[model samples]
Target: MGKSERNITNWKQYNQALVNRGSVTFWLDEAAVNAWHCTKHHGGRGRGFQFSDTAIETALMLKGIFKLSLRATEGFINSLFQLMKIPLIAPDYSCISKRAKRRCCLNKRNLFRFP
Candidate 1:
């Protein structure tokens, strides 16, 4: 036998499936969002951190997963927030870099957990 033949009978359904395949879904847990900003103050001379460690970790995780540069990672996170209609801001690239450098050792924790 040669190559098999296929028929397209449902054009609308086929088109919809194609579009759905390219669609992506993202959501932020309310608890995670609440923890995005650091609430505990370290009582330092200079200004304290605005974003929490979880936020920075999440940003760095995204950067690594997407293979994006620092600036691009910031932009990507900001865009995701905007798309989700969340009144939150992503950590700037500089902040990410600073925090990333400050980490002495990487902990054995799952960084990709959402819930």
Candidate 2:
């Protein structure tokens, strides 16, 4: 076993696996993001004052752009947003609740549009 790709038969220590992956930098370009922005979900409430493009954009970015965990995803989104010049980083587990593999946040869905 001189070959670098060979898998160790026993767990001695320093086990490594080589993964061939496409770089994120290639995909995070403006063209890709702009396309995603146009297709992202637009939840309906018959708007008088609805959620900003930023909130939805952040949500989409977490779920699609960065492909982060819902907890981490929501955390990232919350961190970037501001309410009346205040940082809106709410680390609420219930913010991305999962009862049966389906996320549900009844309160936050209607929580002043993440303003």
Candidate 3:
């Protein structure tokens, strides 16, 4: 074997990291769900939302991380909540799409800001 291929570097650490990735303990905490409610306020009719901004952000993160479609992301989050036995409601795929669109539109306006 060539010198470059002769030795395995940090193979144990790499293996452990891979193992750790499968553990759901990281984002499955009750605090993660609770943080969503702390800032939620019902300002008026049609203004109150069932899911929190944090929940939406988390769903987006999961969608990108797992390469899921909007519908699939909804199902994925639902399953996670069920597994965790948390009494939280999951947002629908359409909700995700709407929020993502609004977020993109806002970001576009901010993209041209100089300061």
lDDT of 3 at 62: 76
- At residue 49, give the lDDT of candidate 3: 68
**Whole-model lDDT per candidate:** 0.83, 0.41, 0.70
Candidate 3 segments exceeding 4 Å error: 1-26, 37-39, 42-45, 104-115
What would the TM-scores of all predictions be? 0.68, 0.28, 0.63
Ranked by TM-score, the better of candidates 2 and 3 is 3
Q: Which stretches of candidate 2 lie over 4 Å from their true place?
A: 1-50, 80-86, 89-115
Q: Write the per-residue lDDT of candidate 3 for residues 66-101, one digit (tens) a residue.
A: 678889998888887788778776788898778666
Cα RMSD for candidates in order: 5.7, 11.6, 5.4
lDDT of 1 by residue, 1-115 (tens): 9765978899999999999987766687888888999998858788889999889988888787677898999999999999988889999999999988774223346534432
lDDT of 1 at 29: 81
C-alpha-based local distance difference test score of model 1:
0.83
Q: How many clashing residue pairs, candidate 2?
A: 0
Q: RMSD of candidate 2 to the true fold?
A: 11.6
